[model samples]
Target: MRSALIAGTLLLAIIATIFFDEVRSLECYVCSRQEGNAEKCLTTTKTCESDENACQSEIRWGSTPYWSQGAEKQYYVTKKCAKKEDCEEYVNRFTSSCQRIWYEDWKCGECCQGDRCNYYIIMGAGNLKATWLLSLVTAVVIFRHIFAS
Candidate 1:
């Protein structure tokens, strides 16, 4: 009887974890060539197609030669649903990270899993690198501390 109780408890815990830990469908911010980091990009949300497993954000510059934000008209951002494999492929092929080149006209692509995981993506070179770097470092420290114990 005690053995049966232990088995049942273990099964219950496993099932509970499976059900509670991860989400089935991914959500992402949906914006297209929005000028600047518009407020709409931050607040807008959408459920991606079932096949899309990730969210992607890119910084685009149009017809600008200078290495600085030319104008609100020149700088734009597009954040949308993406497939994890595709986004990763581009990131691997073209650049090391979405950060760097915080100058101007830097084509940045980044993807993440989980619901609304791409919410932290910011435009512009300086702020984008700093924010993402800070977030990445903080997350690393937290995970290390949590797992090290």
Candidate 2:
């Protein structure tokens, strides 16, 4: 009986801790195209500033001559942590569409909430957290209520 009571109390404490946990700042992929290498951005991540709640990505596409046969197209990308408002304004600046430059280069950008949301140039927020902790707490609460009654 004593062991059962102690276990129940421990479970409740764990549940309460989870409920009162501090909120974490959003994390995002952060890098820029350097020396024509955009892939470097894929390996770095940053915990965004408290006010920087969004992930932003910009992609630039252009055509380059391929020696003889034809012109090959290529794109460079950049990613960073940003504020939602700034990202929204940028995405909306072009009427939600890519802008054409020099008739060959196209520039596009996007923003998203959640961690690593800017990992993809065009994708939105990442997957949400699982709810198994909530379910476990609920189950424990019900068990304790039944035991007390």
Candidate 3:
């Protein structure tokens, strides 16, 4: 009975390791943009397609200076599974979808072999600009009211 118990435990351990490896191999996050007021966006897990082996995260920032609101900045972040070659290509270069937004203010692309590695991406500049603009507007309104009254 004792021998049987030892053999069963060994078998269970082996099976557990195999199952864990299988589950860890192909998981990734797929999302077009991050949302909410949180510091980082929450991403859902997904199994990568058969041809995909790398996790990739990409961010694009656009700037426009046409208005009185100062330079408006736009950001787009994406996370997904992709082929290794494609991931490498993206890392070296980027393509712009909008012709009008000539200044791609900032861009970042990362590729990783591990599962779910593309989960978190943060770009502080855009958020800081937005917050600063809000504060400036608020201060202007407050001053205007004080002077008028």
The top-ranked prediction according to lDDT is 2
User: Candidate 2, which segments miss by more than 4 Å at Cα?
Assistant: 1-22, 34-38, 63-72, 96-103, 125-149
* Structural similarity to truth (TM-score) of each candidate: 0.58, 0.59, 0.51
Q: Per-model C-alpha lDDT, please?
A: 0.64, 0.69, 0.59
Evaluation by TM-score, superior candidate among 1 and 2 = 2
What is the per-residue lDDT of model 1 for residues 17-129, given as tens digits with 9 covering 90 to 100?
54553345667888887776678778899988878877887766554444464443265777888887997787576574443444434566777766666666642212132
Model 3: per-residue lDDT, tens digit, 1-149? 55555555655555565556545556667776553212343447678887887777776665533434456676666778898799879877753432334454666776766556565553221112233345456556555655555
**Where does candidate 3 have its weakest 10-residue lDDT segment?**
122-131
Which regions of candidate 3 deviate over 4 angstroms? Answer: 1-25, 35-41, 64-71, 95-104, 122-149
lDDT computed for candidate 2: 0.69
Candidate order by lDDT, highest to lowest?
2, 1, 3
Give the top-scoring candidate (TM-score): 2
Cα lDDT for residue 50, candidate 1: 78
Candidate that beats the other on lDDT, 1 or 2, i.e. the better one: 2
